[model samples]
Target: MTMQSLGDVVGNLVDGIGNERYWRGGKIAEPGVYAGVDIERYHHDPDLFDGFSISSSGLRALLRRPAEYWWSSPYNPSSQEPESKPALDFGKAAHMLLLGEDGFAGQYSLRPATYTDSKGDEKPWNGNATSCKDWLAQQAKAGRTVITETDIAHIRHMADALSRKEAIRLGILNGKIERSIFHKDRDIWLKSRPDVIPISSGDFVDLKTAASVDDETLSRAIFAHGYHVQAGLLRVIVREILGPDAFTSFTFVFVEKAPPYDVRVMQLKDADIDIGERQARQGLKLLRECLRRQEWPGYDGFDQHISYIEMPSWAKTRIDNELNAEAA
Candidate 1:
């Protein structure tokens, strides 16, 4: 969109991803979005903006706490590591089952021996068994994901629950899935891949697997995971590619990762989207500044002064009441 050739875009964003591992096979019918794009490739694609993505998670990691971001992000040479593989695996499985349609089975295998151990006793299968490991290696070789039987059950339960929702069902049954969309705005690269983008409607949905979707737990999860920022990013990217009227509404479908697999569907308010957009902008500005200076400064470098540590009001109230009772 910004007049860069496809080669330039690929060159800029191709640092981490090797040449052989391109977005293997999927193609999109949509006008602007790209299908079958790998997560890493989209993040690093140069077509968006100089091969840098102001991702929601990256922004949160950097702005929420610079020191942590420096340690975790690959941008830092001293302490770079991949994210939790188990969690990523679980989510990947869930997405495949919920959105990937027929291809989900090919990408995953359930451990047949996970139900028991050496003593033939029932165990949760920590994925450490030698046989399990060997099977997983084979799955990897075959370009498939290895998962525990329990993982299959959990994902299945969530899938069943999702099918009960007419709106979600129709969207999934009728729409496109897992297309990576990008937009360049103000010299910044932004991208979003909604779990489900209905071809027939102007609404998009993001599926989230969590501990619980109750009001309190979900709200905390939203804030902690920067779901608001993600919502804004997704909306903005979609709006740019499709049009201002493209994303009339956004929804979050939350399902418990554990038993009962309770599900909740939420539509974010306009105010929530606004707040997220604001945070995303701030994060992008900071990212631009950091890249331009070629320095990723930590928090200690900025405000190292020992500031006042305010106690929680609830804790203070409890302390005061206990002291009064003791005096009485």
Candidate 2:
């Protein structure tokens, strides 16, 4: 008998969910390759890896606070209350409309107007609103997609605007969407799900709902969110899993959550990705070291050291300009 590959071992474990082979009908399946399953399965499964999945978001967390990462990561075998995030819900709805297989029908239902308030606002009637809300919750609990009619409209507006962009439309003409890929190196399991992976071009695209897509605003947002890290790491992982022919470049399609629903397809050039790769490398090295030591420290001797807060560059630049003006 030959030893199974790590990917096969993981896949078998996940496949045993709700069966006698593993947890004996456990509600949540283990982490592994699940073909012909809802994409949500990959997103909600907490038991996907014995150690840490080291996601791009998790990389950011590791960079921020190692102790928090250690305590909250799957390796700790601890749990936390699943709090509802309205922003995340809204983003999921947008993702459903933009990338999911069923488009709108798979995620939402309609309700009729039921009651008129004293302020003259008519709410959905016949308990329809409540019913829809309950259904949405149920769908989410089942690891299925769900959304609102208002969210649908918002998505349509963004789609229409995006369609107007000839280059982007051409780039996204035919590609895979919402496919989760994982790479395990030693104890570290790196995972990424590109929103869209272009087939022939080998370029991936991620959809994001943001407040603004302006040059400066989006640039700052990208930096603040560590999206570059995500982009760089995802490219490397996809290549590692699927091979060098699988990933070449990355792009982010940013859509405004409100109003005219402006859409911007921002492509990170080699230069930007180079910086991201450096950051990712640093985070990965730190993560590996912390995991090996099993001691997640906070702020590297922060208790003993006295640190000074420095003025931000933008503020310092403004101050310098004002001082120079005064001298003139």
Candidate 3:
């Protein structure tokens, strides 16, 4: 068991994520079995790489395309703008914030571009080495217990499964009558908007980050805000792309960064879920509309029209009625 200081591990791999190029001045030229399409070939014909061919087309070419295109290109920033709101950007999330995930129903979904340069040294979602070191220094000054991955792993002598207990409870205590997970199959016409379709379990599992958390505080807050809407949108998109087998539940695992690195699992209920679904549907519609209008939603700037809608009354009413019926 290797228990080095938290300062040692992590923040080293994705330490400088915001950079346009690899963190290291030189390419992360590690000779390993990296699974991905050849970038050189992608340059000529992105389709050969997969569905991302159109999405990955050169910059100048995309600029000539129309505004209604849902896919993004080098110069044509069709996706959310950098100045956009605090919504999760998978690339930025993985590189800037460790909050983004992929791989399985709810594992880590890393893009090929990112995985190509990765070395497993740093974690970006939590910020890079600079932010992490600064936070660590602050923690050290306060005399709090520092539990780095190495320390935790050594103490428990277990490999990465941090949420083992909860997983067992979900799988064993609860009869997962059905469960499903999937990745978004990227294409030129469409983007990678993948999500898991839990046949049951009553919710769509969402992931998020927090500076710190206990247990109880996690449940109430996300009711107001979190990435649940994103999950809901993913649900709707998955249903649209795959078929109608969307998830029935919405779970959020808000991982804290403070001492203890505690994780809070909150099962979104009636109102919480209602809001997400409402927004999910709305956002999807809005995104397409925006694409058609060639007007991307701006996060940094305000939208006077959007502010008029207060969580949607119809959705809330339906949610309340459902809760009342369930209780009855």
Best by lDDT: 1
- Between candidates 2 and 3, name the one with more favorable lDDT: 2
lDDT tens readout by residue for model 1, 1-328 = 3444444433322321121122454422223466667665445333433445555667777778666666765445567544548877898788777776556666677667444566777765566776556766788789676777778888888888887877666563455665666677666556676776655556567888887778999888888888888888777777677655566667888888887788788887879888988888777877777778767777654555866778899999999999999999
Best by TM-score: 1
Better of 2 and 3 by TM-score: 2
Q: Report the CA-based lDDT of candidate 1 relative to the real structure.
A: 0.68
Q: Is candidate 1 or candidate 2 better by TM-score?
A: 1
What TM-score would you give candidate 2 relative to the actual structure?
0.69
Please report how far candidate 2 places residue 48 from its true position, in Å. Answer: 2.6
Candidate order (lDDT): 1, 2, 3
TM-score of each model, in listed order? 0.73, 0.69, 0.38
RMSD of each: 8.3, 8.3, 18.0
Question: Where does model 3 exceed 4 Å of error?
Answer: 1-164, 168-203, 214-226, 241-246, 297-328
lDDT of 3 by residue, 179-272 (tens): 2222232212322222222323334454455544655465545543434455554454444433343334456655543345455566666565
Q: What RMSD does model 2 have?
A: 8.3
If both were scored by TM-score, which would come out higher, candidate 1 or candidate 3? Answer: 1
